[model samples]
Target: MTQTRRAIVLLSGGLDSATCLAIARNMGFESYALSVAYGQRHAAELTASKRVAEALGAREHRLAMVNLGQFGGSALTDPTIAIPEDGGDGGIPVTYVPARNTVMLSIALGWAEVLGAQDIFVGVNAVDYSGYPDCRPEYIQAFEAMANLATKAGVEGARMTIHAPLIKLSKAEIIALGTRLGVDYGMTVTCYQADDQGRACGRCEACRLRRAGFQAAGLDDPTPYQIPER
Candidate 1:
């Protein structure tokens, strides 16, 4: 019998992560979808995560509730800090949670070790991102190296691999690819401050990028938005 190759996919219930999950499944992996509840302002995130996991036919779905809101460093984790609507000026945006990817990938690594899986997938993009320092290709490489050295499984020759399939992809390219793979963007939420109904605020940076991507892809924008008429 052929052994099932398992992969831990870090699913944020957003556009990129959902597409990343689909890509892992397409690569013949038994995907274990992992979502982190790091005290994000968007309450709809976890709900969307559940939707994506079920819709994409993940082998298993798990939620890790680690409240990073206690830190109060980012807008996503702290309600006091306002989510910017300028669509990102230059530097890293306020939505860039401190050490978020590190913590998320660390959780993924621990679960992978327990599940006897060596593959982990993250959907970080460089091109059309919010300028999060952790989303860069260099950061992904460094994290993979750390994963190989930090775990007991790695010492036993089970070298871990961190897969960032959407790292270099533009938002339009990603949307196009995910569309071809049957991803329902309407089911996913990327807004920094989505309402309980999972409707996106069309003015935030995330919404701007996502809306632009759909336009560039020449695809129908199926995402539900709560935009005030100007």
Candidate 2:
């Protein structure tokens, strides 16, 4: 019998992340889901992450609590800054958490080394995404290179690959793909300001993009939003 390879998936409990997890499973990897409670304004997605991990059949799910809120530059981490309803006016929006992806991937990399897994999956997209500098292909590539150089396993000649499966995919494409994979989108939360119960605000940038994705995919969005579309 062939041994199943293990993979560490960075599950953010969002649409994209959930899809990434599904993709990893479809590829026959024994997935270990990792979520971070990184001092965001709400824990709604963290709650959703648990549901996603169970539904996706992850071998193990772990949460690392890090207080990124103490740094508090982005609206997600700082309560003082309001989440933009208009999606901002281009450039890197205020929603960009400084070094968030780097920090998260660093954590995932450490876990991967310990687990002896060379693959790490993250759902970072360049298309139909918030303007976060860290979500770019260049950033992902740089991180992959850094991971290979920084890890002891890499020093021992084990190659590490960071997988950003959704990097080039449009939101509509992602939704359609995840739908085919039997992912229940209702269990995921993409709202930047979701309520404690995980109900989306529907006006935030994340909600707008998600709503448009479902529309473009010609599928009904299963998200429960606090505010209905007019």
Candidate 3:
């Protein structure tokens, strides 16, 4: 009998993470989804994450909260910082939360150690990046190295792999992959400043990317973009 490979997937309820989670499942890993409530502007994604996890047959779906709002530098956690409408250009955007991915991955690594899961999957991408430093491939590699050194599993010579399946995939390609895996577009959320009722602002960088990806893929996004009449 083939042994079941266990993977800890970081699910964010956004298109990328949803696609990554599906990819992990399709590769025959028993997925254990981990989501963090890091005081981002869009906490609605967590609810979406729950739906996606159950739909994708994740063995476990856990939502962990951390008070990153206390140390705010990004638009997500700070009410003072406005969500950029143009998506910004070059370097890092104002949306870049310092060490956001690192912090999240640290929690994931700790959970992975407890679960004895060597494989950890994240949805970070560089091809269609948000100009965040942590989204770069080198950062992921460096983090993986640090992870190996920081954990007992690595000290004992365990083979630990950090999987970033969507790291190189373009936004359109991510949409395509998720579509192939039957990921429901409606079950995901990508708006940075969704309305009180959880409707997308359709102007934030996240919403812009999502809309563009769906348009680029020629796939009808079921989610409401709520494009305000201009």
**Tens digits of per-residue lDDT for model 3 on 124-226?**
9998768788888899899999988988999898868899988888899999989999999887888888764567888877887888888999999777666
Model 1 poorest ten-residue lDDT run = 87-96
Q: Estimate the TM-score of every prediction.
A: 0.98, 0.97, 0.95
Q: Rank the candidates by TM-score, best first.
A: 1, 2, 3
Q: After superposition, how far is residue 109 of candidate 3 from its true place, in Å?
A: 0.6
- Tell me which of candidates 1 and 3 scores higher on TM-score: 1
In model 1, pairs of residues that clash are: none
Backbone clash numbers for all candidates listed:
0, 0, 0
| Candidate 2 least-lDDT 10 residues | 221-230
Q: What is the lDDT of candidate 2?
A: 0.94
Local accuracy by lDDT, each model: 0.94, 0.94, 0.88
Deviation from native of the Cα of residue 113 in model 3, angstroms: 0.9
